[model samples]
Target chain A: MTEPSAKRGIAVEQAVVYGLLTALGLFAFVVALGYGLFLDEFRVGPGLVPAVVGGLITLIAGWELVATLRGQRTPHDKGLAEIVAAAAEAPPGGVSSDDDLPGGTLPSGEQAGEGTSDGVDIFGRTAAMRGRQLVIVFVALTVSVLLVPLLGFLGSFFLLSLFISAAVERRSWISATIVSFAAVAVIYLVFVVFLRVPLPAGLIGIGG
Target chain B: MLDNLVLGFSTALTPENLLWCFVGVLIGTVVGVLPGLGSTTGVAVLLPLTLSLEPVTGLIMLAGIYYGSQYGGTITSVLISTPGEASSVVTTLDGYQMARQGRAGAALAISAIGSFVAAIISLGLLVALAPPFARFALDFGPPEMLAVMILGLATIVSFAGDNRALGLLMALTGLLISTVGVEPGSGTSRFTFHSIYLLGGVPFVEVMIGLFAVGEVLYQIREGAAAPIRAGFRELLISKADLKRSAAPILRGSFLGFLFGILPGAGSTLASFMAYGIEKRVSKRGHEFGTGAIEGVAAPESANNAAANANFVPTLTLGIPGGATTAVLLGAFMINGIQPGPLLFDEQPALVWGLLASFFIGNVILLVLNLPLAPVFAQILRVPYGYMYPMILLTSLVGAYSISNSMYSVWVVLIFGIIGYFMKRLDLPMAPLVLGLVLGPLFEKALVQTSAIGDGNIGIVFTRPLALAVMALAIIQIVAPSLMARLLRRRNSSRARKADQAAEDKTEEHSHG
Candidate 1:
């Protein structure tokens, strides 16, 4: 019953992404054109390749946006399915739950959606929970990066670790503190003592 | 060849080189076992540290990480049905089943053996073929080189994702990003916007670390956590029967993986899947494939490892990356002031040969290490992600800053990390984008040279037979997949319509009766 809405939601998201990409492509195209796409015979300008590439990007991205609006499947949507469909058709032990297949594994031959993490499908979560966690993580990372110069690398990282472990993961303060310190110590030994990286030591001026 | 081998061993056998090699593989195993880290990120984040070492030593360690991750990925797959690397995805099919049936140790053992055998076989082929291929490539001029780069880009775009347009877009975007620095032919800065850091260009290693490390961490955090299965060391033994069944599949997978790996973008993941699919078709126990067939575990495991080794052929000889991880390795080459191409063989024979010999040594170390410690390695998964992810995040940011001791580099990592996160959510392939970025400078240089050679008529590509041949291949790569897919769709729909018509006819006759 909710399948159609879920699919529509994906389409809308894709439309937004493609729209932004189209804008970027157009901007690049215009900028490259301003730089003089072609110079003269026997020699091309610096902008020639960029102009062509930018124009192509604009066209393709715009076309993709339309296709998303039209609800059309991509030409290659079936590639991964074709490879693993035969195997997935049969159930090996009714392995359905995360607990059944450890390491948070997905079904057979599913494309590892992300390049890292190796094919674990972490979908089927409530949208609210996933969104909240993602937002929090992103915010935490931003704040940490902003704090790096001011608080110094190690000091800022220590607090970041504390926030993630204590605030995000909801661990006990003691455990979070322990984790944070351990992580900082390792970073110090590796980057500072061992490799001699000359990390920033902000106003506090420690662990440089 | 004999003298090259001697030089390789002598260089590789140094105490310092061997130590770094061990450190690399050991770290690689840990990186592979972790959820959000892979060899690409591992190499990138750790790359700055290696700059302190000798070039050959640094390269040997980095290559060790590449192949070591292949072995490490299987441990997770067999023990917990989780593939630590993309190429190991197929192993979970029969590998997990084996674990459920009290043969977890056997599954791990067989994978280690198969990977070792495949590495040996693929390395042999790489050693023999790469030099000759480089020698042949020396004859290529600007037009031919331009065609080759185009072919590389085309092949990657075709194979990277379901949407060819998306893949091409990402590649173009990478090329666009690569144009930020001053133009090679003319000293005009295209996209610097007047920043000092922008003059040098967006650092590729930092981008890689951001995309693969921090980006993956953010993505995985949303995934939360999962319970892992436990495998006891006492149960980790393989029977004689298991060995006999796996022998053929391992050999078949080795050759097949090597073939795929030599291509520009058909990576280890594809090779493993193909090997498993073919093994299923050919094996007499085909029906047992999904039900823990030993051959199933053996084939894919062997294929992924072989493919990992074979990826070096194109990377070392042609300067074109074999896959995403190798793209980062190519960046490492450039970071070390080394340019990889046909000239690399003659110019840096010691570094090249020494690096190759280390692969042989590294695999031997992996086999010996994995055989005794598969269960021990699986224990790493027990560490909570909460502790691990924070560390990874810190390392990525710090690593970026360490690259050139600039806050600008850190900012680039942070921005690209966000971009990578969004790309993952949208299912945009990262490999094509990375390959494009790595190839952009080389590609542009070729383009400019070709234009000069042909007096501004790029159409001269059609005149040279070698260039023409390569261009034809590029066109085929770009067009063939979609064409074949359309044909298949048509056939399927026609068959479906015929079946529907038969059903309607049967219903009409019944009503009349």
Candidate 2:
């Protein structure tokens, strides 16, 4: 009974994706057209390939959008039946759950539906947890990058690894600290000492 | 040839080269066993480190990593039902089932042994054929090169996944992305948007790290925890009957995989799939394919390894990469100012021969490393995601930063990581995209060169017999997959309709009775 709605949802999602891709293609096409098709002496200009590629992309994306609107399933949707069949044949207790299955959930977690604060549902909990972890990790990486100029490579790396492990992943602080330090030290030695990479050194600067 | 081989052995047998080979394979094995990271990511992440080393030694190490990961990929597939590499996807069908039935050791052992045997066979073929192939390719002009590139792209697009259009789209997108910097011939600014960083172009290695490593880490984290399987040392041994049963499949898979691998863009993943499919059709116990069939495990494992070695053929001889890992290796070659082509053998015999000889040594190292450590490697599954994912993120970030020592590259990694995540969600194949990005500049150059050579005549491509033949092949490749799929679907539907009609007739008879 819910199959139709699921199909519609996927179609809508695909349409949106294709629409965005078409827009990107159109933008690139316009920009590339401005760059001109030929330079001096009949030589092909920089814009030629990009323009053609952009045009192709626009055409393909438009076709995809129309297909989606016409209720055609994306290639991924067609593969789901195979996946389901394979999952069914999987050994007893081989899979932890359907949620853990590869390609099971949408990246946005929209397919899993909404999550409650209590987190009773396994799928909801997993989606919510994953979303939180992804954000945390992303932020951690961004902060680490920002910190590299101020704190130097080793200092920033140590802090980044520690924060991600201890705070984000929720590992024990002691172990995180140990692992972070060890990892940073090894990287420092390898890049700076042995390979002679001349990594950036900021406030606590020791010139390579 | 023999003298060159002796020289190769002399260079490869050096302590420095041997050590690097071991390190490369070791790192490859670890990354390969990890669920998210594959040989592509492994080679990309480690590439910057190799930049400081001698070109020959670095390449030998990189080559080791390339094939070593094939052996490592089997470990996860056999033990966990998770394929560590895309090529290992088929291995999970019967391998995980065998693991569930308490034969994890046997599965792991057979996979390692099969991979080793296939590696040896493929390596021998590579040595025998690569020089002649390169010599033949030396005759190829711009039109022929373009045709070959087109063929490669077509094969990848056709075989990428269920969606041919999506694959083509991704490949086109990659080509578009590659056009972001300065134009090669005209010295004109491209889609740089006036930024200095953009002027230099997007760093390929950073993009690779972001897409494969960071994107993969995010996916794994989202997957949460999976149930871990434990395999003891006792389970590592395969029975003599098991070996006898696997022997034919291994040999068949090796040859099939090698053939597929030598073709441009049809990589180890396709080779493994084809091997599994062929094995199912040919084996006596074919009906029991997805249910703990030893041949199922042996075929794909052996095939992937063979394909991994065979990939070097095109990469070295034609300067064309068969897959993503080889694309990175191609980048590595360029980074070292060593252009890989027909001229490479003549220009740098030591580097070429030494790298080949190292493959022989590296395969031996991998066989030794994988067999005894299969059970030990399985224990890596016991490591909590919490500990592992954070370290992966750290490595990715550091790897990205270290590449150019620029914060911009780090940002590139982060951005591409997100893009990769979304691409995965949308079920876009990443390989075609990477291939396009890597091959885009070369494709463009070939196109321009062909145009100039032909005096702007579009029909000149048809004039060259070799180019015409390749184009014909490309067209067939593009048409064949869909044609086969349609036929298969029609056959299945007709059979189902017949079954339904028979059931209805039976019901009518019962009602009359």
Candidate 3:
């Protein structure tokens, strides 16, 4: 990773920290005023302490902004220096994978850095496929919950087993169905018959 | 006592309660294994089902789940480093590090054994020390409670080392949020916003589920659920050296946990952190803290379990709830029409002893189950998040809605999830916040009652010997530990002290130099 120039890195860090301070300061100031105007107990209103605290935050933020702009750095607080140390001398500006970052992976392959593949459209396909996977899984879960009311425990679970295994579990059709059927049967017998917890009975009349 | 205990055993050893206990442990472990599920939500879901059974039976089930889940949680922390609950975060430091070194088996084995020893010691303390201990909690009337809470509030200043101001703000935010629905002094509702359900205020389970479980899901959703890190089953059990190293720390931690457990409002997590802190201070090895140390695992693990079990004393004896789980247990007591407090032994020896018997039964069951099942519980950490979160969202929706069957609550839970997510992202600890909220009303009520009893003077609190003792104990709880550490540093050999200089306060020292 190519390290960014010190000047450029410092400038970026200053902008980010100062920018956050300005935003938070403004938001807190406005909220404090609104609290005074609306909420009761204005003299010792719950908002009063919050407003004072918010004001202090804003002041420190403003102070930090000024110090950074002036380049009057404190001993313990080297915002830019810390960033440089962390980023280190690795391949600085390049994405390791187009589709992901370490903390949270992106849904699209274009994010992972392969736009140069002539007419490949890798990013769009990866993103679309990921999105489709989420939608299918969500639907399967929602269907299982909804079906619990109608198909009863046994039947609804059977269908749920099939859809989840087939769509999300990524298995052979027979294997998915078999696992689904068997698991649901176990849950059904344990919760319903053995425990005798009341369960919904469907048109199949399984509840007895 | 032995005959009564035997009789108690006879009562709890029945087929039905035993079966419920098994079911509870199984359900507890499942919920504990899942990231977005916890003992509180699990209890809330199953609490409704328990409404049909005898209160003792129901409580036995709930208690089983509460302790069982706590044990199950360490599995995740040690294996994948995805903490199953907030308290388990400390476990990850030593635990996952141990796992990475191919001693995962040792970590898992030692944790189960540590937890087992802690549970046994803690239960022994509860039975032996409960009555006289219950007498101590009674000393905390309003003024003393206020002072103690004030001190407890002061603890945030110390605990939130770097972010003191933000921590205080968050704490006050908790104290204030807890005061939202009702005016404890007056009959008037303060901030219900005209909703009937809001009058009940935010339920403890709802807030916990939102903050810990749902909050975490939001972070996971933001970061794709699949962690790149991996550790296999063979590496998951205990090594000989690991067991040898942890034995002493486990012994120390269990003792500490049981002592803290008797105190109202001091729960397992704090017990764990305190145990970790003490073990770090007192252990011959100091540098192994952030890096995986077996003592670190044993300390927190043992303390947390012992604390979890010890909390039962307050609920059983004083009728005053200690923590959230015990509060639920308190509800069970009230439902059973057997008021807790000193009268309990005289009025219903059978019921009380029987319940104690059940705890012993449950602890043994926990020991048996935790070792073999460590690998199984760890598997849930490996479950695809895509599969996990959807189910969490589904269960959360069902759990939140089912409480009052209210849609608005569902929305509130979601909104809190977003807020809770941001809190975690911003690096705020959620425990003290929850503890503040949970204890606030009780603190407020105690304060008012004491003031009234004293005819507005409040001097009666300190003037009373019992009250003074409790307040003194609370302060020592805060200061004594730190002072002892510094003293330990100062008195140790000069070379040792020089070696420990790195642990000294270094806030502006490096910067100035």
Best by DockQ: 1
> Can you tell me which runs of candidate 2 are displaced by over 4 Å?
A1-17, A39-43, A66-72, A76-125, A204-208, B490-513
Instruction: Report the lDDT tens digits of candidate 2 across residue range B1-513.
Output: 899899999999999999999998887887777766778878877787887889999998888888888888788777766676778877877887788778888899899899989998998999999999889999999889899889888877876655778989999999999998888787778888889899877777788888877887776565555545555444767899999999999999999999989988878887887788778768987757677889989998999899998988988988888988898899899879888888998899999999999988998888888878877776776776667766667677766777777878789988998888767656787878888998898899998887787666547899999999999998998787656556556655675577668768888999999
Candidate 2: residue A87 Cα off by (Å): 16
User: Each prediction's Cα RMSD?
Assistant: 5.1, 5.2, 10.5
* lDDT of each residue in A49-94, candidate 1, tens digit only: 7788778888988998888888885555434323342343232332
Q: How many residue pairs clash in each candidate?
A: 1, 1, 23
- Candidate 2 lDDT over A110-157, as tens digits, reads 112122222323323454577677778777777877877888877887
The true-versus-predicted C-alpha distance at residue B171 of model 2, in Å, is 0.7
**Each prediction's DockQ against the real complex:** 0.32, 0.28, 0.06
Each model's C-alpha lDDT? Answer: 0.81, 0.78, 0.60
**Which residue pairs of candidate 2 clash?**
B105-B235
lDDT of 3 at A140: 58
Candidate 2 global TM-score: 0.89
lDDT of 2 at A194: 83
lDDT of 1 by residue, B1-513 (tens): 989999999999999999999999988887777645678878887888787789999999998888899999888877766778877878888888888888888998999999999999999999999999999999999888889888888878877766678889899988888877888788878877898889888889989988888887776765555554456545867899999999999999999999878887667887887788778768877657767789989998999999999988889988999889999999889989998899999999999999999999999999999998888888898887766888788888887888788888888998888888878767788888999899988888888888887788888889999999999988997777757667656654675577568768888999999
Give the runs in model 3 whose Cα sits over 4 Å from its true position. Answer: A1-208, B1-4, B35-49, B136-141, B145-171, B174-186, B199-202, B228-230, B233-245, B263-265, B280-296, B314-355, B405-412, B459-462, B472-513
